[model samples]
Target: MIQYELQQVTQQYNGKTVLNIKKLEIESGKIYGLLGANGAGKTTLFNILSFLEAPASGQVVFAGQSVFFGRTELHKLRRRVVMVDQYPIMFTTTVFKNIEFGLKIRGMTKERRQAVIDEALDMVDLAAYRGASAAELSGGETQRLALARALALSPEVMLCDEPTANVDVENQAVIRALLTRVNLETRCTILFTSHDRLQAAGLADETVVLEKGELVDTSYENIFSCSLESKGKGQKICLLQQKIPFSLPGFVPEAEGRDYRVYLNPDKIKLVQGGQQVQQRRGVLFGTINLMMAEGEKVRLIVNAGVMVTVLLPVDEYAQLRLAIGDAVTLKLKPDAVEWL
Candidate 1:
C-alpha cells in the first residue's frame, strides 16, 4: 500500500522556489533515506509530509485519500504521523512524564498510558532513565527520548530528521538499532534524512536523493564540482578540483568551459593497490585509501586523490585486495561510472 503520494509538489520561501518534486510515492512499512546536503529541501519536504506546512502547489494523497491543506483534519493527521527533529527538544520534566504527556493529551487512561510509556522507553532502552530528568540526559539519550515520545503514540508514520546528527557514537549505534527494531516489530513506515551516504545505504531499504531542491536519480556519494574542457576530436575532460580529469564523449553541446556537477556511483568503481597491474585507462584515478568501513556484505572505501571519492566493493573482493587505510590505491571507474548531474 502507498502511504503517501505527492504530485507537482512545489514549495517556495520568500519568492524563491525551494522544493519542486514532480512526483513521489512513499510506500507503506518501508524505510526511506532522504539523502541530501543541508538546505536541499529535505526539511521543506518533511514539513509537508508531517502536515506542519502545506506545499504552495501540489496534490498530497495520504492513506488513499487526497489531502486538502485547510479542508483536511491536519491535527488528527499529525497524531498518526510524528516528526523527530535534528535537535530534538526536551520537556523540563521526567522522562516518564515526557512520554506520558502526549498520551494524556489523546485522553488515554492512566493505566493504558503507563503501559505505553513502559514499552516505548524499553524500545529506546531508556527504561532506566524513566525517573531521570529529561533535560539532564545525554545528547543520544535525549534523542532516544524524543523517539520514545513519538513511539508512545504508536504513530503509523515516523519522520526523523538527522536523528543521530548530534549524538555520541555509542548513541548513534543504539539509535540505529532501535529504528531497525521498531520497523521490524511494529512495521511502522519510516522516512529519515541523513547526509552520511554509508549510514543511509546501510539503514534505508530505498534511498531518495535531492540536489539543489530537486530530486536526483542517483545516490548522494562521489558528487564533485567539475568543469568541462574540450580535449580535441569531439571529446571533453571533466575536471575535478582542477586536477583529476574524467574523459567523456563530447555528445553534450555547449558544455566546454561551463561548470557542472558529476556523480560517480560507488558500486561502479573498482579499487586496487598502487602497484596493481591495471592498464593506464581513461577512468583510472590514483588516490590513497583514507578510510575503509564495513557495510554488511560490502566494504565502503574512501579515497583521497585531491578530491574524496567513495567506492563500494563486496567483502570478498575487498579481502582479496588486502587493502588498508593510508595505502596508495587506484580507482578504476567503469565505462558507465561517470554520471552528469
Candidate 2:
C-alpha cells in the first residue's frame, strides 16, 4: 500500500521557490533513504510531510485519504505519522517518564503504559537507564530515547532526519541496527535523510537524491557531473579534473562543450594493488588511497587519482589486499560499469 503520496508539492519562501516536487510516493513497510547535500530541501520536504509547515501549493494523500492543510484531518493523520528530528529534545525528567508522556496523552491504562514503555526501552537497549534522568543521558542515549518514544506510539510511518548525525561512530551503528530491527519486526514505514552515501546504501531499501530543491535521481550516489574532454573510437571520454579520463559507451552528447551527468556504480569498480596488471577490457587508473573505512560487509575506499573516486570491495577481497590509507592502488573500471544519467 502507498503510505504517503505528494502531488505537485511546492514550497516557497519570500516568493522564492525552495522545494518543487512534481510527484513522489512513499510505499508502506519499507525503508527509504532520502540522500542529499546540505540545503537540498530535505528538511523542507520533511517539514511538509510531518505537517509542521504547509506547502505553498500541493496535496498530500495519506493511506488513500487526501490531507488538507489547516484541517482537523491533518491532526488525525499526524497520529499515525511521527517525526524524530536531527537533534532530539528530551523532557526534563526520567527516561521512563519521557516515553510514557505520549502514552498517557493517548489515555493508555497504567499497566499497559508500563508494558509498552518497557518494551520500547528494551528495543533500544536502554532498559537499564529507564529511571535515569533524561538530562544526564549522552547524545546517543538521548537519540535512542527519542526513538523509543516514537516506537511506543506504534506509529504507521516514521520520519527520521539525520538521527545519528551528531552521535559518535559507535552510536551510529547502534541506531542503524535499531532502525533495521524496527522496520523488520514492526514493519513500520521509515523515511530517513542522510548525506552519507554508504549509510544510505546500507540502510535504505531504495535511495532518492535531492539536489537544489529538486528530485534528481534515485541512483544519486553513483551519479557524477562532468564535462566531456574528447571523443575517440566511437566513444566519448570525459576527464574528471583533467586527471581521470573514462569513456562513455553509447552516449553521444548533443553538444560536446556542455557538461553532463553520468552514473557509475561503486561496486562495479575493482580495486587492486598498484603494480598489478589485468588485461582484456575497460581501463585502469593508479592513485593513492585517501581514505578507507569498513562499511558493513564491504570496505569503502576513497582513491585520489585526480578526482576522488569511491570504490567498495568485499571484506574478503579487502583483507587479501591488505590495503590502508596512504597506500597506492589501481582502480579497474569495467566498460559496462559506467552508465549515462
Candidate 3:
C-alpha cells in the first residue's frame, strides 16, 4: 500500500552532474538496495528523497499526494521518513534524550515518549547504554545510536546510507541481520547501498546497479543468472549462434531435457593437430608455445596472448610431438569441450 515515485530526477554539483535517476518507484515493505562503487551517487539520491535538496526539475509522488521542494510540506513529510547516516550526530546530550528528540518535537506525552525510547534502545541492543553520554561512545556504538534514534521515530520509510561501512566484519554481519529483522518486524520499506557481493546477493530481493550514474543492469534474477553462467565458462569457447540466442541462449531443453548434460567440462578437451583444413566439429588456433611445464602426464602451456591453460596427454604423445619451448603449435577445441559455469 506504500508508493514512492520519481520521474527524471537530476542533480548538478561543481559544474558536473552527480545524480540522474529516471523513473524510480518503491513499494512499502521491501528492502531494495542501491549498490555500486564509490562515487555512484547513492548519497545524492538519498538527499533527493529526503528533500534536503530538490532535483533540477521533476515530479514526485509519495503515498498518494504530490510533493514539492517547499520547506513546510517537506517538513511534514520528513516526520514519516527517517535517514540514518553513516555517522551518528552528537549533541553533547545523554543518549536517552537523543532517542526521544523526535517525539518531543511532535509534542507527544512524556510517558509515551519514554516508552518509545525504551523500545528503540532495546531493539538496537543499546538499552543498557541509554544513560551513557553520546559524545563518549565508540564508532560502532555511535552508528547503533543513529539507527536507534531513527527507529524511535517509527518512520514509514527508512534510508540507511552505508550504516555498516565503518564497523568491523563481524559487526557488519550483525548490522545486516538487524536491518533484515527490522524490515520483517516493522514492514518499513528499506533501501541500502553495499559493496559486499555476498551481502547484496543474500539480503536484497531487488538490486539496482548504477555505473557512474547510469544503470548497467536492473533485474534481480536474470542478472545473477547471467553471472552464474558467465564465470569460468568464458575461457575462449565459441557459441554456435544458431542453436542459442534465438530461444533460450545456451539452454536446450528440447534436445535432451534431463537425460543429457548441456554443459561440457573444458578440462577434458584433448588437442590433436592433423587435418590441413579443420573440420566443422573441431576448433583450431595456431599460437607459439612460450613455455611448457610437465605435470605428470599432463602439460601446462602459455600461448595466444599469454593465456594459462592445461592439456592432458600421454607421455608417449609428448615424446612423439617433441614439443619444446618457443615451438609453434596449434590448439583445438569444440563447442562441447567447455562446461557451463
Ordering by lDDT: 1, 2, 3
Cα lDDT of model 1 by residue, 239-325, tens digit: 886677765432344656777877888998878788442433467788888889887898989898778999999999999999989
- The lDDT of each candidate is 0.87, 0.84, 0.66
lDDT of 3 by residue, 245-324 (tens): 11122333332212222222224445454333333222444456565655455555544312333455566777777777
Please provide the root mean square deviation of candidate 1 (C-alpha atoms, Å): 3.9
TM-scores of the models, in the given order?
Answer: 0.83, 0.75, 0.64
Clashes of 2: 0
Error of 1 at 141 (Å): 1.0
Can you write out model 2's per-residue Cα lDDT over 191-290, one digit (the tens) per residue? 9999887788789897778877888754466566777755556555676544456654444465677767666678888888875334323467667999
Question: How many steric clashes does model 1 contain?
Answer: 0
lDDT minimum window of 10 residues, candidate 1? 246-255
Better of 2 and 3 by TM-score: 2
- Please rank every candidate by TM-score, starting with the best: 1, 2, 3
